[model samples]
Target: MKKDSTMKRVLKLLKPYTGFIILSLIFALGTVISTLMIPVLEGRAVDHIIGKGKVDFSGLLFVLKEIAAVAAVTFFCQLFMNLINNHITYSVAKTLRQRAFERLLRVPVKVIDSESHGDIASRIVTDADSFTDGLLLGFTQLFTGIMTIAGTIIFMIRIRFTIALIVIAATPVSLLIAKFISGRTYRYFTQQSKDRGDLTEYIDERISLEDLVSQLGAGELSKEEFVKKNNKLTDSATKATFYSSLTNPSTRFVNAVIYAVVGVVGAFLAVAGSISVGELTSFLGYAREYARPFNEITGVITEMQNAMACAARIFEIIDQDQVEDCDGEFDGEVKGAVDMEHVDFSYVPEKPLITDLNVKVNPGEKVAIVGPTGAGKTTLINLLMRFYDVNAGSVKVDGRDIRTVSRNALRSRFGMVLQETFLFSGTIRDNLTLGKPDATDEEIIEASKAAHAHEFIRKLPDGYDTVLSPSGTLSQGQKQLLCIARLMLALPPMLILDEATSSIDTRTEMKIQDAFNKMMKGRTTFVVAHRLQTIRDADMILYMENGHVLEQGNHKELLAKNGYYAKLYRSQFMS
Candidate 1:
């Protein structure tokens, strides 16, 4: 992205606080003016003491009191300026975080799946941290530095145009140093931010899959990989720091040159009749005041580069195209009939998952889809839910093209229990009632009983109110049962069990099968199962192979046909 774009986007976020910024600028102007006037007053006091060739006690006292009053006003103005600047900084940070989070909610599932959770999270957390820190310092330095520079130059020209030329000549040296250093380091800083995000993602993945890594004896390998990523981040950060470090000392050297030129030239001018001793003293003071902040400005420049990099990442996510709007508005009740006509899709367009697939189901039929791993089983579920759109053809519900239906309305009819169960960090009651927000306690208990989860839930310390985290101590089967119970309460007109009973033992599977039988009574159901036992009684069984419906019939009919279904069934149970 262009640097201007990044700058403009950040400024756009700050645009709403124009009035506040103006007020800050006013305060800042007062502080700078008050601060500059002090040296002038001090110079005049020096002139008075020397011109008299004796200490003028009362005159000195009045000068001292005037300087104190100006200093006091400068202090208050500086305080108010910082307060306003801090408010803008923190306000921008808060608003940026909110917008990014809201975009996270509205972003497509495809985008979410493509990006790691940690990278997105870093944009919200890590990037925001740098942004808040950098911006707080950036705006504060920028306003004060600009005002001080302009004010000093104007005052310096009035005092001595020749000395003023020296400061002006040295000014670009500081700017050029800042520019050159920032240019060299911006890319490294950007890379460092990305590498940091990758590290966060890696850590989260490692922790979540700790048991699997250890069980597979890949712990050392994973650690090596982590080290590699960590080194990349460290290297990028080192390079950024190294380049940015050059700015301050280099600019401070130019600052020293400016001071030297002013001193040497001012001494001659003071000796000759060209400038007064007091005027020369004030000019030197103004030069120091003007040049000192380049040191601070250079520091701000380093941080600004980092902040701009972070802001770019944030804008990248915020600027992503949102999910396609599901057009048309319909409140018609879904009767649960679904169809896929010549449907085709691929997560990657060059590698197809499903092609020319056609299927039909009546309003309340029990349908089972049996397939091997990677046979596009889950992809079918994604399509049906419109979590993704088909690259070609269409999936229809109740003879209406789903593409024409609003996503929320179409998805409202489906309640799914997947092989991988996910529970949010919340009370059991919260997870259970997600599908039916108004589900009463009695209804929740009944649903839990139907899914065989109530007995264990009641035995827990808090029963339905037991809070659960994603990494909570709940057993795999227990979590699955809770997921089932949650869906049972939902009781959508259509039901899906995608290897939902994988973790359950034979005895518990049988019990859940009974519950599934009860749950499937009034709903149009779809089951994707590896265990043949769960779907033996499905009204229609589809045997899929390599994304195609190779054969399909009732269980007995498929077995009678002596096809893949019968072979798959025997492979699991006949031994």
Candidate 2:
């Protein structure tokens, strides 16, 4: 999006806080009026002391008191304005962050899977922070600066119109300089934000896989890649800073010229007896006040440019196409009969993966799917779960199209345990009760025992209350066991086990396999496994290759046929 468009969207976010903004503007005006009074009062006091001998003491004393009162008013007004600015800054930032996160949850899973996770995180956290900083500066300085300039001009024109005209004529020169310099910095700041995201993504990716990097002895290589990204970020930041930094000094130079010109003209006017020394004094002060906002605004423009760039990145996520779900709920109990009719799907449209694939499995049947890597094994499971919709056909459960049902209702019926395990940073009880929050203690124990996790849980320092993180002390097999125990607690009518025992040892695998056999008795089960021995007793075995079911039959039948499944079966058993 363009800068102007991004700014308009940001303004919409602040619409709810218009009351605070109006109050701030009110105080800003009060501050400017009080500040303008000081110079006028000070000029009056100077006139009161006429060549030391002919002094107007009462007039001088009264002007000094007025100056003191106005100064106090200015301080209080400024203090209140600053408080309002801070409130507006952080509140808008919080709103943006909350909206960005809500969008993340609503958007399609493919949208998230396609983007860099670290970059998305940066936009929500780091970019929001930068935007707030710029916003705060704009609120505190930009508004006040503009007001001060206007007030100073009115005061100066009252004192002497000619001098005010000179200052006004030079005003556009300072503004043109600021605009020219600030315009060039936007692209640089944009590049800087992107580079920072790239660096963050690289760091998060490398750190998350530190164990693999160490095992492969690629630590040095990883460091080198990190350094490359870091250096690139540094270059972009330095260049952006270099360009933005020019605005302040450039405007300051033009302001100083205006200040000098005002002083020279005021002195000539004073000599000609057209204006008093007191009025000249006030005019010089007004000239300084008028020029000051130009400098401050130029600096604010620099930060505003950076803020707009970050905001554009944040809005990109918020504006993504959300995953659409129907309002339909299941009409009756789900019986786990699943069928895929002429289903076609591909991650990328140019390269088709699963095409016109068909599958059917009745309720209470144990179906095993075996395939090599990249043979669309996991992709099939994804289709069934409705993580991605089929491009050409329908996936049906209990003879109704799955897409017609709400995603939450459809997913809640299946219990799945995949190869990779994820444990939140909470007590084991919290993680176990996620799917069934109202599960009783007895039920938790029973599920744990069934998954062979109870013995290990009992050995922990706090049993089920022990906290666990993804990088906690638990081993891979232990975490996988906990995942199984979680599914057991839920006990959905259908099950999908995708190498669920891949992390466990042979002994544990045997025990878990027995437990799974008992669990699979009444429910329809789909098992995707690389180890052929684990699925020998399945009622039907599907051998898939390149998204097509090459052969499917029970162990005896496929063996008799001497097909692909038999060849795969012999490799594992006879090798």
Candidate 3:
């Protein structure tokens, strides 16, 4: 589907903030009015002071005092405009951030995993910041600049209509200049935004692996690599900045020409006695005022180019296809029987992972899926969790087709522990209670003991309350233990363990297995393991290869058969 362009979407984002915008317009109006009156007042003072005989200081003084009053009004108006600017800018940025983050949460796991972590993080923060800084200030200046041009045109016409036409005629040239410059430069700004995102991702990746790099003693090598990336970023920025800088000076030149023309033409009319000296002065002032907005607008045009580039990226995320929503309702309580019927699946459709596959397990069965690397072990697990839907056919959990089940409702019945452990930044107790937020302290301890994590957790300074940073705060094995404890606390009707005990010591794995055996009486469990010994006692074992189940039986049956499973088992243990 064709998405709306960035400029159109950004204008749409401004709709909710209209009230703040209207208030800013009010302030802008006041500022422009006060500002335009200055030229008229100064023209009067000039005429009064330069009169033939008497200085007429009294009249000049009155004009000066009015000028002071208008200046004061202008100052207050500008101050209010700035306040309004901040309010609108910050509110818009906040809404964009919230929208981006909420979408981030609901996007498919595959989509989220495909992006660089740093690039995603930068879009939520750095891009939004640029959008706010550029658009807010630009809108503010745009409002005042446009109003100034209109007000000056009216005032100048009152002084002399022909000269006013002259001022208006030259305005389009300034616009033409802007259009030409921006066409050449806008793409560079877009490229610069992309390059900066890459740089952010590179730095973030480096920082995340800082400990490993330090241990490797490759700090200097890392520095040299970073400098190369930094140079690419710098070169792009310099090119973009160079072009945007041209906007102001080019417009200024056109404005200067307009100012000079008004002066010369008005001087000729003054000599012919067609207009008063005071009126001619006002006409010259209007000429300068008329061209000023174009100059300012071109300058803002440069900034808006960058802002529009940022807005485009934000829109790309907003417009991605979201994870499919489940519309089918299943009111029955889950009994944990599962079926994969004639399932066809693939991560990328061209390379099939499973073909016309079918599998069934009764309630409370201990099923182990054993396979070599790239044997579709984890992919099969993903289908059960509804992380990725099938290209053809369906999966039923407790006789309810999972595609019709809301992801939340379907996933709620399963507890999972994968090979890669993840823990949020919080206390160990807090992480344990995540699945069952209402779990009591005693419940936490029970689950931890089941996973054999309680002993080490108690030794920490604050016991279960000990805080953990995002990763590497605890040993990999300890992190894995916490994950198991979390799954135990949830006590879901079904469980999936994907190499869940790979990091644990043999002794610790034995204790956790005992806990699992005790809990497995009436609950269904699916274990994916490469360590054949881990699933030696599974009630039903399926040995798979190249996305097909080649064998199924208990461990002894497979070993006696002396097939592929037997060979893999020997490679790991019998050898």
Candidate 4:
């Protein structure tokens, strides 16, 4: 999108704060009005002493009193405006942050996977911060500069038209300089923001893969790559700052030249008797007044350009297409039956993954899906949860199509335990309540016990109240157990274990399996695992290969058939 259009959209986000914005404008106008009175009073005082050749003490005192009054009012106006502006800006930042986070929740899983974590984080934090700063300070300055210039010009013309004309004529030169620099600055800053996002993504990827890099002895190579990215970011930022910094100084220089010219002309006119000394003094004062705001106008333009660059990035995320949820109401509870007919799917259209596949699970049935790596095991679970819709065919829950039910209702029906566990930076109790926010302390302990995590949790100094940061104080298995405890508390009608025991030791896996057996009663279960031993007791087993079902039946039936399932079992058991 063009820069102007992007900025317009950002300004639209400020609609909710219109009251504060109006208050700011009123204060800004008051400030300018008060400032204008200072020069008028000074010019009058000069006229009384120099032109009249007499001093009126009372008149002098009156002018000084007026100047003092204007000064006081101006200060108060600025103070009030600043206070309101800060509040409005904070509100705007909060709204944008919430919208971005909610978008993440609604976006398709594929969309989230396609973007790097660091880039997304930068958009949320860095870009949003920039937008807030710009909207608050930039808007205030821009509005004040324009209003001051307008009011100052009117007053200058009323005092002396020729002098006003000179100032007006010089205005275009300053604008031209500002306009040229602002364009370049805006483009460079946009590039800088993009580079920053890239750098952030690179750092995030490396940090997350630190152990892998160490094991492969690629630390030096990674460091070199990081340096390269870092240098590019530095270069981009320098260029952006160079252009933006030039604008203010360049504006000031042009205004200085204009000031010299205006002063010389006004002095010549006063000596030649074309204008009085008092008028000339006032004109010169107005000229400087005019120049100051013009200088400010140029600076505001540069800042606005930079702010818009940030806003474009923030709005890009906000404007991304969101995943479509089911439109119909689904207030009733869901049965555990799930059926997929001739489902075909692919992350990219050019490379198909799951094709022409059909699967069905009866209510309260235990079904195990055994497949090799990249055989679409997790993809099936994602589809069932409506994280991504199938390219072809339909998924039905109970008797209704899944598409006819709201996403919240569909997802709320199942409890999922992924291989990689993620815990927030919070207390153990806080993390457990995520699955069921209203679960009581007693219920939380019960669920933890069921997942075999209660004993270990009790060993902690504060147990449920122990504070935990994201990067501190938990083993991988312990985190997984915490997630399991969460799932147990949810007590959904259906359960999905997607390689849930892949990270645990054999003994712990056996214990978790025993816990799973107890939890599986009266629940529809779908177990996706690489370990054949884990699924041997399932009521039904489906061996999948290249999106096709190669074998299906119980362990004994598949072994007697001596098909793909039997071969997979023999290979694992024989080892």
Candidate 2 C-alpha lDDT tens digits along 89-108: 99999999999999999888
Top-scoring candidate (lDDT): 2
Q: Which of 2 and 4 is the better model by TM-score?
A: 2
lDDT of each: 0.89, 0.92, 0.87, 0.85
**lDDT (C-alpha) at residue 225 in model 1:** 98
Candidates in order: C-alpha RMSD to true structure:
2.1, 1.7, 2.6, 2.3
Tens-digit lDDT track for model 1 on 59-175?
888988999999999999999999999999999999998988888777789999999899999989999989899999987888888899889999999998888988898788789
| Candidate 2 clash pair list | none
Please report how far candidate 3 places residue 17 from its true position, in Å.
2.9
lDDT of 3 by residue, 1-575 (tens): 11236777777888888988899999999999999999999889888977578788999999999999999999999999999888888888888888988888789889887898778887888888888878876877899999999999899888888988987888888888898997777788777878888889989888978989999998999899889878988998899899888888999998898899899999999999998788888787778778778878887888888887777777777777888796666677688899989998888868988988888888998899988889988889889988888989889988878988799888888999999998999999989998999999999999999999999999999999899998645899999999999999999889898899899999989989898887777888899998878899888788888888888888899999999888888999968
Q: Candidate 3 versus the native: TM-score?
A: 0.92
Worst 10 residues of 3 by lDDT: 1-10
- Clashes counted in candidate 2 amount to 0
lDDT of 4 by residue, 38-122 (tens): 8888887776675355787788888888889989999998889888888987788888888888888877778788888788898
In model 3, where do residues sit more than 4 Å from their true spots?
1-4, 51-57, 211-225, 267-281, 327-329, 459-463
lDDT of 2 at 183: 96
Query: Residue 553 lDDT in model 4?
Result: 89
Question: What's each prediction's clash count?
Answer: 0, 0, 0, 0
